[model samples]
Target: MQTSSNTRCCIVGGGPAGMMLGLLLARAGVAVTVLEKHGDFLRDFRGDTVHPSTLDILSELGLKKRFDALPQHRVTGIEGLFADGIHALGDFRGLKPFPYMALVPQWDLLTLLADEAERYPNFTLRMRCEATELIRREDTGRVAGVITHTPEGPLHIGADLVIGCDGRHSRLRNAAGLRPRDLGSPMDVLWFRLPRHATDPDGTYGVPGRGTLLVLLNRTDYWQIACVIPKGGAAQLRERPIAEFQARIARRVDFLGDRVNSIASWDDIKLLEVRVDRLPQWHCPGLLLIGDAAHAMSPIGGVGINLAIQDAVAAANLLAPVLLAPGLPDEATLAAVQQRRLLPTKIIQAIQIFLQRRIIARVLAAHDDGKLVALPGAARFLLRFRLIRSIPARVFGVGFRREHIDSP
Candidate 1:
């Protein structure tokens, strides 16, 4: 394994969170290396909805044009449909510039960010490199760097700071003895891609009354669908035939029956257990946790990526002073980052859990007739009310401003 002469920051994981943080820091002229286990950016059907607040961040970075050039579908808003033909649609058009979310494939998003990050001279992207263990300074019990498994052999790289964006199962978090507190309702998602028929609109495929199924219609005749199911229900579905899976989905959302010509194979359906978890502390000494490593959000509200980007912004903003300073990050600077982000993270996590339990799951289980009538009224109120949506956006997007970071 080769080592760089001057490594300032070591970022683990090349997902959205890692890539975004790398880009932000690289643009700031910091020496950053992103180590990712995956060799390529092409992945299937990952989270794709880019929220309004995230769009605002992209615009701020002047990367909005690059993102817009990608194959994306503009979603004006989100809608909740009940089984009874009732629906609540939340129109995001009230926001400036672009009112809607953009449905771009996660692979495209990561590739785009990685490409932008490469434009910086100090940025290095290392693929197929896995972070194996956390290295610590023996005298002070402070994290010094990480030991990674490279193509040739195990390499130990020291850095001024180690940022853990390795996701929920973070080795860095575990090495730091940080335990995440679970705050999400138990649920799982069965994700699959099916051919989108000619009849399907070039928009979101939402049920009027139920909230279990989330469908995104892509450019071609292809639609990505994520259906919420019981935590361990994946195995049972895997045992059933593809036809059984199609029938089950049809029963959940009737519109799929009309738009879907055929159900993809069961193997094509990916199952992920959803959970929300947050660490007690975001940093300890020279190590820090961001994205899923710090706070894991439920996929119910489609805010995971947006929140991750927000974490990157907060980290970059807070660490800017330290990066440009004469010394490493002090306890106060680290604490400031955590302090600045804690409340907003907590609030957004609460909202995601509430939406899943109170809204999504409730609508999914309700009878068809009960869902239809209940959704429209709820949707209209939320769409028209600026306070309801904007408050959460502020919490999840910009975070507490720099001035408010030290405030109580």
Candidate 2:
């Protein structure tokens, strides 16, 4: 084990939540170190949707201009296609500042955050370091540090407080004995990319076919395709020939015109095992969990990354004051972060579960027909009202509560 290095706060996992928290804390004059397992941010097919809430965050930090400069796709409205026609869900026409959700590659978002964090002298980023275990203070039995593995060897990092932002399968969450209560999901997603042409449909679109849901996100040059299938169905799909998927998916999406065959082999398809769950307890004394580390979200709204970034903002707002004064985060400080964020997290998850059980599963089980299956009564009512349509846009775009830049 390497010698211990101390900081005011140590953040595990350099995802949006971790990096955002680290940057905010560092800007508040609190020493912060962020450990990323990967050497660089280059992963593909990850969640890339930057909701209006996050865009607002960038605006608050005065980074909106820079963020807007990056290559991104803007969605003014999220539309759904049935067998007959399209239904509009989220319409961002009259919203202020940014009326659209920006879809930029997640790697670029992380890199942007890191670059800004590096501007602060108190910020430290250690890439290619994976946090393996949470170190507990023997006297108080509170987490005091993290043991990480780097290319050189085992490294011990001690801090007054440790935040776990390591994503859904976080090791720190497990080490702290925080168990996420699985909220059961009915489907998984198979993701692949196909080239985009001028004739292709514009904006983010979803098409619900009998027995399946196909969502297409428009990238500048390609389309990110997600095929929602029944839980544990990916194995069976792989058992069939690769060409079968191309034909089946293309037939469902009449607009794709055989471009679905871009999936050359099984290697091109990435299976995302959908999960909906949250940790009952997000913190223990000196340790706290944020983002997907505490709650894993379904992809229905593409709001997971946005929610995680919101969590980071809340944590920074609550915890920065204590850290800046050179004090360890007390139980109350940790609890406040959870108490403030838990409601939004729960509300979003409940909505996701409701949609999963009522709509998605039923759609997956429906037999093929020329007519589009009717949406549930509540869905129709919500979509019918002129005023209610924006509710979902607000929920998915801005969330229940918007945290402010209270730190520094």
- Count of steric clashes across candidates, in order: 16, 0
Write down the RMSD of candidate 2 (Cα, Å): 1.9
Residue 226 lDDT in candidate 2 = 93
Model 1 Cα lDDT, one tens digit per residue, 54-99: 7877777778998999988887655445544433245565666667
State each model's CA lDDT, in order.
0.73, 0.89
Candidate 1: residue 324 Cα off by (Å): 2.3
103-146 in candidate 2: lDDT tens per residue?
A: 89999999999999999999999999999998888898989999
Extract clashing residue pairs from model 2.
none
Positional deviation of residue 374's Cα in model 1 after best superposition, in angstroms = 6.2
Q: TM-score each candidate.
A: 0.87, 0.96
The lDDT leader among the candidates is 2
Model 2 reaches what TM-score against the true structure? Answer: 0.96
